[model samples]
Target: MEKYDNIDELTGLYNLNGILSHLQGHETRAAEGSIVIIYLNVMNFKSFNQRYGFVGGNEFLRGLAGEIKGLFPEELIARTAGDQFIILANSLDEKEITDRLTMLSEASARHDKGLRLHIKAGIYQQTGDETDPVIMVDRAKIACDDIIRVYDKSINFYDEALSKKNELRQYVIDNFESAFKNRYFKVYYQKEVRALTGKVCGYEALARWQDPVIGIISPLVFIEVLEDVHLIHKLDLCIIDMVCKDLRDDINSGYAVEPVSVNLSQLDFELCDIMAEIDKCRDRYDIPVELLHIEVTESALTTGADFLDQQIKKFRQAGYEIWMDDFGSGYSSLNNLKTFDIDVLKIDMDFLRTFDTNKKTPVILAMIVNMAKELGIHTLAEGVETKEQYEFLRRIGCEKLQGYLFGKPTPVDDFNRAVDCSFDVCEDFSLASYYDRIGEVNFLGNTPLRDKSFEIFNNLPLAIIELQDDIAQCIYANRAYLDYLSSLGFASLSEANSIYGTTNHPDIVEFTACLKRAQVSPDHRAYADIVTNGNTVNHKIRFLFDSGNRQAFAVVSRNTSIHEESDTAESLRVAMAHVFNQYFRVDFFDEDGTVDNIFLNADQKSVSDYTRDAKEAVRLYSEMYIYPEDKERFKKFYDITTVRDRIENTKSAYVVDYYRSATPGDNGRMQMYMILPFYYNGKWKFISLCRYADEIRDDDLK
Candidate 1:
């Protein structure tokens, strides 16, 4: 059973500091001297999401999380965004694992149906040699990297290269949001050229962020984080928007602008309605869509080929070409040719690394180039830096080449000036004039609640949950639902396995199934305490269901014990007035209700004054501040919900006039923007309030 004292209500991620009484229990469990790290990531979460929607994507994740919990008890689990899920288990067997996995896999396949969940599981045994549990998990993760990317039987052990990448990736995650606004992130472009002529054709946009303190940011590091914060698509949009604006202006200034290709993240594919957004850009910039090109990772194409196909069709309709990027990066690259329509296939630079005139290069390169030609697809060689590499590619009949041979990525402004009227329109040209060496570069750069948290007791709705027997599955939760897990130890949720932390604290079995059932039902609301029992927690819980899979649960924890009701009339007025301003508009009136002041939910005092008008119209309209249709509704609501004295004011506005409103939603919900008619001086006038609910408890106000 999960029990804790404090439930943090801020961000959804769990914290350390959990069940203190079980501290010794954790030590003993660690002393069992056996630990297993299972780095299990959901394969193709981004693809699934792109095909479905975010809600469905999350439903898949939540459901999978539940199934995983059922498979392992006394294991720590934390969702590392996208499809990655980590598990740290204490004292388990090899045979038991296989049996458990087979059982779970069959069950999941049955339950998930069309929303298939093919998981990549990486395992490592902790021999107590590793000081940090995270390191043990890293070892397991190294084992799973290829499996995650491509399901294979050969599990790799941790190596220097993988570990280095892991450290870089983990660091980016730890500082994701903060890194975006930091100085590190910047653009890096690789040149794309016409192969036969060996001149620069275009540049494939890239990202490189270098930090003074943190070195470089790797794409592996920040990409997952970007997806979590919903910023990847925004970043892509920002880049595309900037490029379109800059490129259009340059083209008109007599610059021969070759189409540039931009790499799109999976997050971009999912969040953005690319077709509509692209059309908007085309119209806005009045530029031919063919002037732009987009490259999708071959892996990305392999998983969500249909979506890419539709996008490709859309772009072509809008007159743009599509390229399959990093063609040799994975085995799926070749398959993508069969599955997806493409205008170009950019050869990976790795092939060049093995190039020697007489060696393995000529036959393979010649064969690939011939294949592209036979298929009627253009072949572009990527990373042709040296004269020898460029010359060799040209002889092979490749149509395009991109590398340091022509010019590296330059600033948009620099490229515009550098490429202007400089080379033959038909010949492959170089941006060599603008290419310059940059210093060292650095790295480039989801879920809800669960059960096990409901064991603790709390007040109001937050405590309103009943576990599904000892399975500890949360069948319900109230408004403060999710906040009950914050500040709870994350060891359970994370790899620490402290027995008190959230990452692993309470394993809720089949959690996704319950949520799916609830989501489709009208009575989907429920409550549970998401913290431990040892401490005095004032948190609430919230339950949300994943719409797509409908099986996953997004348990949100909230702190709702701070509402303070004041006795003083002014204090009460501020509190009530704030609720109105925050959610709607509120007004106040005097005892006799004889021309008491009026409250207007806005500033710009130069406009009509509510106090003056409210008093004059009070007798005829007690519903003076409220809309006529809402007047009776508000009256009844006030009668039942309000506990204060004598029909206080009973007026409010976001009103431009007696019959009209200022802004559509200006009726109440904004403290400073609210207009409160008070009995000030001899007349009634609406006083603007810019107060919030929590600020009402402040003694400084009195």
Candidate 2:
């Protein structure tokens, strides 16, 4: 009935039926010519189809068929599946077949821009014993699959080893659902230790599959196989759900549970809504967002794919911490860091191992640590297997560490046991020394300052100034110092000091000279008498210099005659200082909905605009940083009436709420704003702390 009954409608090629019927005649004359069956595949055809639509994919196939026909017109050809082409060539050697295939690839690329094909092939040379076309085709397909599995290989011949691997892969695919139903999959975790303290801060989740029939399968092998079969998303989602359930169980059982990071492939986002999937598991198990972390590799971000950008934003907005794993293994590793809102930079252990052999490796590692610090991003060194690598990274200011040195990834029971007894870093390891190496001049807890001096600095009756530069500038000062300046009708410490005339004041002059001398000597101090507020008081000015941070500090302690301010002003000062030191930006709005003051902690490496002008600050907050969809909501929340009502109705001393906005780095990542309305200076003033959404928690806010 049909003229070419076995012809493929799309490619005009002989279908499998026609090819097999044609092959029946060739089998009788096998001895007359050498027969080689070649199976060609369009690698990543699904990705191409996704990148371009179905129509585009079909067009590419049609163009590819034309090129294949031009190269092998006399050979028997067939369209097997969507992206596979089979060819039976006679009287041609292996070299001739290779040459023709290479030519066909180039011609296809030249014909149409969209027709460039990444071809992988498998070959089977027919023997005199072979008679069935189905057997030969199956062997060729197995050979093709071997080349595809390697990915780097272009072609492979059918062999026993490749056939075995194919059989294993088929077994996995056929029994995947059964294995899952029988609870064969498992989630393992490796502890991530704090480098300075050696405390187990968190764990990284890894997958394990135990097949009853096959005993155990390596994750690397099975993960690749799952990806090939488009079942990786199912596995990834399963792992997420398992991790969440485990976290909930651990908490219920009173096991000290830490956050666990999970690896997600690019395909996970492509297959379904990643955010929705996460929400499904989170809601099902009632898991807190902070208990889970998302890890994407450096290579994944290097693809410059739009899907990653969209998915990352949604994850961040939903308060999920994002870690960039394998930091230095990609071509665009450093560039990806600049573009992504990656909270932790997990340096690959390969970089550390190379330090012993490569002269420039340590320098590069140091540079990465410094760059990450300057960008306000924390660094985590992964795969640390030796004491030397751990010390080296600690010295270079890596915040977190994880590897074989701590302990390998283990099952839930083993991980809990290992972490139960707590561990400490080596006895000789000093956190202060590590801090010195990183040039951290400011200490928050348990500082080495004299006890009396520390108390006076916080609860002093006078202004305490900490100068960080050679010039008469203040980097930090206590609440008493700020209040004193405000009492003098000065808006800022800088303005008040300028009016005091530091050049003529002997104490100020000596303080500047002491800082310069401390650049070379550690123990440097200068004392002098100066008149302030109509009183001549003795002042003790000490120069503290940190060579590592390349910073010089002048700690000036003088007797303050005034100890108290208006209750509201004092409360405002304390809140402002705490918010400023912790967050990148803090804004204080008056009861009239006007920005009264703004404090910005700008990273030198990043672009920033921190204008003190109230009107301009309001415009920047409302128009520039706030996303279009959130602007109206943000405005409504911060309105004068809304603020007054919230503070009154809220039982807590401060009314706390959250809103989203933009930051200088990673435009897609919205900054979480903790808006608190407090009674300050006899009116309702809202103080908002601007931080990355991942770092905030609803429970903590409440």
Candidate 3:
């Protein structure tokens, strides 16, 4: 009866009491040398049991115990607790112990029905100083718990460092209640600004621990400890309450108040009615529900996904906005976006951490923004600390922005003081309306002339200008439009604006008439021919928006000469070829290395015999016209197969190569060849251009 009572019924292994009794007889041997105590726990055992039945779980444990006994036949083993096992070894052979542990882990995995059974081991080497087996087991347990949340490590050794860490963790857990009641956790607000205009649109609330005895405790330290103890929900709720009170006070003080967002932990929903607590705080403070946004991390949705989905629905139905925080930080980010109806995606700052060094970061960021826009969800880029990052996000149509560039997280009072002093806070701004207007314009069109540089509109080929009010004040112009202004004898857009304000230029009058027509038109689009510097230019005007005192129109300009009734298709083709030849000598080729056509200015005489094969023709031309030093480069540039592969691999619209000409009247001037690939009808075609390098702006090449 005593033997049966000392053994575990499920695995027929020694129980805790049996192990302690055996250890008492080995104390004299332990005092002679060092002994090792290994504590092992099955990770996620509860979830495993939930998946497999209790009978199945018991069977798995029995199999694992059998494997452990087979591997450590000479050592004493015990089934101390549920999903936990203890081993007492007389010798401290680290390699031998690790080898057996590895075999046990592998055997358990091989028999894991369908779910992988992960086992974590903690080893404590005793120098014969302590006689208490319970204390040794406890120390081993501490080492195991230390790595409970770590994924890469499976085994840890007990040491004084781990002991100290456990002590600190216990201290935090013991004083959590006191910290909450005494208001040691303070709320900090980080401003979120409109990307288009640097105006404060909203703020995110963060919690900071101000310990009375230890000065300011970093959230990184306390937050992790609280999360491990499942007390993070308490701190999160306290933060929500503090944010609500602060907003109410701000309203009472007649300060401009924007929506403040609060973060919630996953445990909050499981431990308490988080939604109800939030609603209670809102009602208690008499604050509007719309003024409070809820942010949940993407990783939080991985566990209890269905419950979180329902909870998110409840919050949305209650008129609270839901933002998925730390997007792209987890593996299931896209799945979570599809499962939950998220309003905004707070992009992870890790993407921008290597923004300068990593080339893929900007491309990934742009794709995320575009994908969110297509799904009708907004985007907010966090950790924007530079002007370059700000401009990039703005150009990519990111709706909201946050980071140290605008301001760091601060206390409510300090934030208010900064706002009163110099912070640019937007009052009564409607972010929805702003994004709605921005969404109407398709900045990246599928047209052939559209530039691939999505980071800046200045690289676009068409002249884009923004006009305001009835008098047609030029408010903004892209680089193309600025160049167009310079063509009309104005050094800059400001010079042209000065002329429009002082005198009635015929072009201004015609543009103003076009703007009025666009405003009244059903589709808000109109076209007009404006005369400037003895040349007629066609302007297509579209009404953008009207803000009581001012109205804006987007004006796209093109030369009207080609649109004349007298110009036939053949004449237009010839005229266009001639215009293109003025800047670049052109060649058209098919994918099969066939030169279909060529266009050159009168000054550029053909120097090689015409050939049907495009690749051979390039080689022949390079020999005849390329400088001796640049012949190899010129030939390589025209390698049709290489160019085709490059375009396809990079998805680039065009590729450019630079070289010099060796022709008799040429002075070895730097020349650029640009190759553009296109799919026409049923086959691929390439358009190649030869131009003097100095004539083109660097921005145009982008």
Candidate 4:
């Protein structure tokens, strides 16, 4: 029974039971020699197992056991727990213990050349009155934790207070389920408000417990206890059920209740079919799925990408919106956004909390909000405790905000009152007051059509301006245009209105001349270099005279400041081929194998020849011009079907392929065709770069 129960089969080390038995036997027998039990722990053992395989981890443990046996003869050694070992060291002082630990560290370093193993030991001196071996071991483990944190220390003596703390923790774990069943565990809600309108949009459900023994216990304490006991999922499920019941009650009461977001732990999924449990709760209460939101922490997503993605898909499929909570609180914030299809990104409060201390915090917050907007995801700033933080978030266009300033987590009754009041107040504020404050719609005489038009274009990703050509004073500028000007250090449209032709600025003078010409011919298009905020940028301008309105409008299109050279080259080539149809024919091959050809009037016979029948030309190039040896490769590489499939599968904008093309020209020249394949308007098009045989490098294939 001792052998089966006490010995670890893999490493031949005595188990936790054996360690206890040895300590108890020594106490019963009154063994002499001042015995001290030292609990040893391998630091970051989980990381070790991840770096080396489980088999290797077991071997390493066995090897370390052997070395320990050699270091202390006739000592009782036991594997207490994961990466934890217990040793009964007799007749040894602190110095002797320290020396032994030093030797063990050196031996471990020598054993594994790639890895340096760190070991920490906690010592408990046994006295005659000490009866419970479990308590003694617990105290030693507590000391080991202290040593683990302080890297300079190799060994530490057990403290009485740590033992008491451990007893409290153990008590909480033992009574968790009973307390939860007795209604001590409860759900509290904190309202999430829209930053711009200050309207309560939803609530985040937070767990709280009023323990009988411990009185009101913070979730910060009980949550760790539950997690340690592998019972956090139980708490999460209970909270979800409570939220659903509350939502159903509110709906029955004829109150418009916002959706409540429930936090989930990574272990929740590992513990059970959480989705099934959530569905059961929803079905039982007959609650709409939209009323319950699922929030998973960003840190939880790091370990299991594929599994979490599947879980998220299931949640979304079941009509539940998923919010990535505590975003940027851990590593890979941007990566989490890319990997998960989250509906809302909740920025970590740490960003807002450090706003005053860190100069770059607000900039980072703004950038994150901008990035989320760019990805078509709404952003929620968490922990907005101050009016300054709220106003800053609002100015930066953060869609949602939640913090102490709005309200603390409260009971359902109080939360309902606050929600009702917020929505009522929001209703009193019209859309015009909230969104139409921009100059564009205000300058357009407030007509419904003009306001609707402004609304449509205001939120566009590009900067747009509706300019009156006569005065050239800025009449209307979209949100994008205002944001662009702000980024260039201009405060508003009025401050950045130097682009008007009325200004004596060189850029404006050139732009005015182009507008006048366009007004006369209706086809004159031009570009001007404008200096704003110490930086020069080229703006392409187009003018059109609306005959019915008797007003000429100038459209100023700003080019992106940061564009890749390859993109620029591609854009220029496409534009040149499009505008000068006489120089080179632009052929767009549809995914269905149909081709649209734009003819260029050029002296080259091949240009005219290909433009006459683009489809036949493409077929001949695939059949005849392709080198016989490279025919199969060329066919696969240049096939529009293959390009379309590649783009679809990879979600990539473009793909490039290079192959030998035997042009049907003088000398039957062997030229290299560098094909740039792109998908546009639901079709695939390849722009070929004609390289002469002399210019074809040997490394072109690579």
Candidate 5:
């Protein structure tokens, strides 16, 4: 009856109290040779119980105890706790003990074929230095806990180094509350840059510890300690508050502010209402949701899927962007991408660190970027440290970049001062939106076309140019386009811009017509055959985007090799040119209302000698050519002061006005005049064209 109370009812082994009682009586025997205390712990035991039920778990533990007793027949053994056992062996030979333990593990696995058991042991050698059995057991358990996550090692030996480490961990745990209360932690910001422009687009907030006694502690150490104690959420929340306050200060000081992202540990969600806390901070500071981002690691997605899914949906519904950090660093990255609605994939830096040695790095990175783009998710490459890496990432179409090459993490105040001196800070939120759109385009590589079938568009043997605004400035051109420009006797895109410098250039006029045709076409596409430098080229123009005064188009061109024309074709072409000359004329003006150039196709000698001043020229042309009833309206159409603003307000590339032709004719006929305003060479310019109203499509002008 007395012995029954000391034994575990299920396993028939001595319990914790019984083991301690026996060890207390045999302390003197440890003086002969070192007594080894082996503390055995079964990892993931709760998972096993959940999988197989309490009955099955108890049966497995009983069988496991029998195996342990058989392996150490002469040694004292006791079941100290659930899934834990203590072995008191009178030997110092580690190899012999390890072999017996290995046999015990093998025998248990053989008994339970379905579940593989993982057992870890911590060995402590006692030379009679201390007599307290509880302390000895705790030290052994500490050593075991150190290797709980390390699957490769089955045992850990207690040593002085581990002792000191445990001491520091305890110190951090003891001082954490006071340290946080006194504001010993500081938040540092690392800038996220736009790959193409090298401009600061956002920041990632990182926490740093500023301990008074230890000076500075690495996050690796303190963060691990906090996570071990389940106190990491405090630090994370503290950092968030600091970042929000700093942003509020900057906004009040009239400094340009960008979006800031904060990292949330997995424990944060499990411990507290993280989203509500973040929202509280945001509302307190009055920060826009667009200026705050949330980041979660890929590993964090593996657990609490349903709960995290809800959290993610809540975050997105609240208008915050979610970024997956350390992408490709885990095994299930692709699956995570599909499972969650992530906005940005932060490619792990390890890929870039091993870029030179690992031949597959570049291939893997390209696939990730392309895959994310296809899924409508943006990509940001972290830990980029070299010019070569920057260029390669830019060429591969990475949307954002963050690394040491841009800048190291600094305090918010220091970062602000540095940005003021060296960085291009976006002053207006609208300008930030503009940069966001521009940054999406990769000038060094293939543009992400709207159609999936055109994935290989950039690889085709054709010249490609991305024209923007009404002036059709060559904002971006592929290598083929540059080569085509070289073939046309232009050394660079800048040189090629001379042809598009004036809106009245023949090519510009024709290009504008093609754009208008595209706007009216069902598919928003148009085709044209252009003759430049004695070469005929076929161009396929696709309209991409239009917002306010901004417009983008992709022009794909290929040479036709038809430099010479048949005699009949040449004659017809000349006859068409003669007819076009009789009907069309264009006038160009500078920002100051001065006429810069004129393209008068008709042989009109009377209107050839008008004054150079745009106002005077408009008055003379209106008086000489306009019908009496339309002169004031025609003059208003040429108002240089208001023309550009009107065109901009209209949000169209060109504006049109109707007037009657006053030139000598059999009868008065309605004529249309179009005005195009553009900025070039640091000045605003205007182009005006006159044509028969019947020849122009009314829908095309819209």
Candidate 6:
């Protein structure tokens, strides 16, 4: 009797109803022995399918299975799954384990024109501690994954976390593969609504991947891997060009869906001919110059100034718009604002996450909003998952928000419907669903209340939270909170009531303690004004609170969620500025005596890369000295004097213009920037700007 099923496709575990029945039938006469599961998967089988076609695929797999059955003398080998074989070794000598499995692999390779396949196998000695067969299989699979991820060929036992992680990773891999074939790629536009007047100012274009068979694969896996393989340029072109064509068709039809920003990775700039490609697409679709915006990260701006600046200049000359994406998401220390010629500066969702209605995240977002306002840089944030996060952004003078609170990234059809609907110019959305349904009637000892509480906690849309005794012991917040905390080096809530003082950061342990107290208080609030650790933020206990077991506080956030307007222009310059100013900047002296500033401006950040004021913008005047009237002029001149001079004088040490952006949005306004190189004090530096930005109009030009 076979111990496992034949058509199983998943990696980790398999159901054993068939095996149990087989065991039950023999219960009276068969002697019982331990169920030793020898799980083996031909490593890189997925890669194999991609490399070779089906004809070759079947020959190799079937050969391996035949070998497994023929060679193993003491165990029950079964075709458990695709490219994954399992054996129930009962009452077998443990010493012959390695030799038996190795022989099967060697025999498979010895076939005609065979591929050199490597295998990573997991061995689980199941003694049956109320263990389900499926769970046992999963344990073995996880052990295999653990070894493979770290590139180890050694055997692995069973670890619970490894199993769970393996399950999640396998799900991602399986779903992502299906996603690539289906229409998983899409761009969702959120209207950048002006909070004060409630006008449809523009839109922020967000990328989303959704597949019919696999559901949604978070950008975390696919986007990054694609970028590494230089496939992002294709994805960008597909999405951006699609937005451009859609906008033109919409405008021609009079539906009023404007041009918007499409996010571009730092790697996107490496193509060298990005501008040419964009221009070709725009012209092909008959799209106007006022309708495009190219945006990039701030760190990219500082380093990739020359190539990007050249591209931005071409876009500007051709009448395209420019922007700085992920503003306040990283180091803005050196005030690289002037270096890239940009129109909008996306205030990262991180700031919005920390915006406190009751000083929860604090109005610290105001600093960013006010800065953007003074500089004439438009501000928008993605990942605003709550009403509080949305409202705080608006109150602090921000004009846009995008998150689950507004709506998840939907398909083009769904997006079009939303754009034409009534939500054209408002930031208000709903969050009560994310919380407990307060109106539900509870009948049994507050069991309903408990259920509601858990529902709210488990479903708290954008963040991962940990609570103890009605107070939150820790929180793994969304992208927004992470960016803000990175500048302070206050990341990692693994430990309670602990604070680390980063370079150029003020210790906020005292503030952390107060915030902890508030979780249990009537108001449920606390406050802190800590500095970045060496100009970065880890943002620990930025607002840790214990919102009791009972539906505790009324949500301690300020980022008011907003509705998406399909037709608004989505610019990327703002998003670029957000990241550079908030999280990245590395000060390193070059041969010319200039700091060859290095920064890692990515679409996401790990918990560790926070706690310093972004690379080098000094706290004194860098944060608050620019007057509204002269902000643009001062920035321009500063970039020329510092970044420009360094690059020029050093005879190619650096250049003012280093990065490029090609963001697509819906405001009927596009953004791009140019960085000029210079040399200062025998050192190279960069200067940049997007003169076409709203922040740098004639009034601010000086």
Runs of candidate 5 exceeding 4 Å displacement: 5-14, 26-32, 40-87, 92-122, 127-131, 149-155, 228-230, 328-335, 416-702
lDDT, candidate 4, 409-493, per-residue tens: 8887564454464457333323422431331222212132242321334432233334454445556667755666676666878
lDDT of 1 by residue, 331-435 (tens): 566777887778778888778777764487767877777666545567777767688787767666666777766776665535445543345532322342232
Model 2: worst 10 consecutive residues (lDDT sum)? 600-609
lDDT tens digits by residue: candidate 6, 523-570: 343322223233412122223433555222221221111112211011
The C-alpha stretches of model 2 lying farther than 4 A from their native spots are 1-21, 24-34, 43-84, 90-117, 126-132, 145-151, 196-199, 228-234, 249-256, 270-277, 283-286, 297-304, 326-340, 345-382, 391-398, 416-702
Q: Which stretches of model 1 miss by more than 4 angstroms?
A: 1-31, 34-147, 150-184, 210-216, 227-230, 357-360, 413-421, 424-702
> What are the root-mean-square deviations of the candidates from the true structure over C-alphas?
29.3, 22.6, 19.6, 24.0, 20.1, 27.2
Q: Each candidate's TM vs. the true structure?
A: 0.44, 0.51, 0.60, 0.52, 0.57, 0.36
* Model 5 per-residue lDDT at 95: 91
Give one digit per residue, the lDDT tens place, for model 2 in 139-253.
9988887666453577778876766777788788888899789889998888787776666678899999888878887786678788877888899999999999988886676
Error of 4 at 242 (Å): 1.7
Candidate whose lDDT is highest: 3
On TM-score, the stronger of 1 and 3 is 3
Q: By TM-score, highest first, what's the ranking?
A: 3, 5, 4, 2, 1, 6
Q: Rate the local accuracy (lDDT) of all candidates.
A: 0.52, 0.68, 0.75, 0.67, 0.75, 0.50
Question: lDDT, candidate 1, residue 303?
Answer: 55
Answer with 1 or 5, whichever has the higher lDDT. Answer: 5
Model 6: residues >4 Å from true position, as ranges? 1-183, 332-334, 357-363, 383-392, 415-702
- TM value for model 2: 0.51
